[model samples]
Target: MSAIYDRVALIGLGLIAGSMAHAIREGGLAREVVGYARSAETRETAREINLCDRIVDSAAEAVADADLVVLAVPVGAMAAVAADIAPHLKPGATVTDVGSVKQSVIDAVAPHIPQGIHFVPGHPLAGTEHSGPRAGFASLFRNRWWLLTPLPDTDPAAVDRLTDLVRAMGAKTDRMEPAHHDLVLAVTSHAPHLIAFTMVGVADHLRRVTDEEVVQYSAAGFRDFTRIAASDPTMWRDVFLHNKDATLDILGRFTEELFVLQRAIRMGDGQQLFDYFTRTRAIRRGII
Candidate 1:
């Protein structure tokens, strides 16, 4: 595909940013991909890997003259990054993000956007447990859903341009309402990550299960839990904190369901346990 944007700046050099750089290059989505990270070490690593056409020292420098800027930092860090880059952004530049939660990120970022710039908050529902520059690959977004939550006054032409680049990188694009996006993610991603973390923590606290035994015997459910629990801690912390209301709401419902299951097991209700598993199994199959 032809370059959708003359230049695109990625404001953070983590997995998502790294992956975007690769995809943009592979798909020819942009003529230039300039990357910047808060850490000198990360910038150096990205340079070493040749992750972007240009690895600039400052977020401002990375975004200078770029047609599109991507905020790829944690949700908690969005406000500061937005404030830092607001002054340097090119007029008419379309700004987007790869944050998991939408409403909080938009709230943190939108006000800093200048009059001429378009803020299109987005989330790519794709990742692995691993992080950092080296963890990214070009195909990471292939067939993945990339969601955009644009504000009412956002420029439609800018949104379409960004959508074209995203689709060129092999992702399917869809638009969502910011608050509703947060609730949906809380159900599909936030609560599940919390549960996996909790389950792994419980296993660690179980004195009877030695570390070696846990690791060796973890070829089953516990193994999958560890994979989820092993995700970037900082990112997950920010997600949970920023998406507080929705995450808490989902967790509350999960607790109610857990209580019902616990009662059934305690009362030896074999039929209830079987029925519950059967229903959940169908959901899993449907996803497959």
Candidate 2:
């Protein structure tokens, strides 16, 4: 706790914040961990669980004189959170975020960054289909890629310090351009989540036609999609709303590909299907 910043303020207390607290405490990365939540119930839960050393009622008070501040709120609320805490942020303090959509978060937060302070927008490519403080674990970020999209004028020293802190939490760091990060994540995480949501919805519809016992007989394959589909609606709504362009772009491509498969299946073109399967297999191997 004595090795890194003197005090670290967390602006939200959801899964990402809870994971950061545990990781920081486990690695002794900060001298003090202070947290703030929007709701009284969440603040009380955080205190009862000992998620942070101090649970302040206000965002500004929580960040006062803190060396580092992390905004862990939903993407849609990022700008408001940034505006609320900007005035109270200590001079030269490093501020970062754990939002999924990089470009939108950058747009929301960059304007609120005060002079002499560093804004290094970061996203840890790790999480479960769970939300709230109680669902987090210390090893959530371990072996995950932490993407840092630092502004051009950001101090190199501040970026390095935040990178070191992320590394100490058992994650690797990579510097990425914000737009590129959003595009890549839309393909990997956002699209998959949307597909999972669709698949679960399809199943739910089937329950009306195929009977309510359909899920009772669902195998592991469909069960997995249901689990992912059960993710927090508020968080995902913010993600899609904030990163609409990238998600729509990827979804359009996905539908185009689906039409190609549908054509092959309808025409009984076995060769076309075989070739598509072979190429997709190669891509899967490449991913592995």
Candidate 3:
């Protein structure tokens, strides 16, 4: 594939950004890839590993003269990064983010985007339990859904160019409304993660279950929960905080469902349990 942008700046040189750098390089989607991380040690690691063509010292420097700038930072820090890079971005540059929550990212990043730049909020529904710079792989986004929530007035050409770039990186691109994106993610990702964390915490607090027993006798279900719970703490924290409304709404529905399940179990309503499980099984099958 030909280069979609002459220079692409990746702000936050973590798993997503590092994976992007590899993908862009492997696919020749960008002529030059530059990256910046807030942590000095992270920048050093990025340099040692050749994560990008250039490892810059600051977000402003990384974005300078770049045709595309990607804010791959935590949702809570998007605004600060945006503010830092806005003045340094080249005219007509397109800025996009890989934040999980779209509405909050839009609210935080849109205000700082320069007049000529495009601020497209996006979420790539792909990741592993692992994180950090070393955890990135070139094929991480293959066949994954990368959804963009561009504002109504956003330039069509800019959006199309970004779609091309993401496609070249092996992701299927789709567009969605920011709020709807948040709600969808809440159901698909946020609620499940919260539940996993809660389950792990519950097991830890159980008096009868020792810590060693919990680790040694873990079944597949609890093991999966542990994997989900092991995701980056800071990133998940920011996700829950920024996406509170949608997540809470989903959690409320989840609580109601749990209550129904509990009542059925207490009453020995085998038919009700069977029917509910059958319905949920169909949904899982559909996902597969």
Quick one: ranking by TM-score, best first?
3, 1, 2
lDDT of 2 by residue, 1-288 (tens): 456888999988999999999999887899899999999999999999999989999999999999999999999999999999999999989999999999989998999989988999999999998889787789999999999999898899999999999998999999999999999999999999999999888877773556356568878987888888999999999999988999999999999999999999999999999999999999999999
lDDT of 3 by residue, 1-288 (tens): 788899999999888998999999998988999999999999999999999999989888998899999999999999999988888999999999999999998998899997999988888999988777787889999999999999999999999999999888899999999999999999999999999999999999999989899989999999999999999999999999999999999999999999999999999999999999999999999999
For all predicted structures, in order, the TM-scores are 0.97, 0.97, 0.97
Candidate 1 structure quality by residue, lDDT tens digits, 1-288: 778999999998998999999999888888999999999999999999999999999998999999999999988999999999999999989999999999989888998999999999999999999999888899998999999999998899989988888888889999999999999999999999999999999989999889889999887788989999999999999999999999999999999999999999999999999999999999999999
| RMSD in Å for model 2 | 1.4
Better of 1 and 2 by lDDT: 1
C-alpha lDDT of all candidate models, in order:
0.93, 0.92, 0.93
**174 Cα displacement, candidate 3 (Å):** 0.9
What lDDT does model 2 reach?
0.92
In candidate 2, residue 83 scores what lDDT?
A: 95
Can you give the lDDT of residue 87 in candidate 3? Answer: 85
Model 3, stretches more than 4 Å misplaced? none
Candidate 2, superposed: residue stretches over 4 Å from native: 207-213
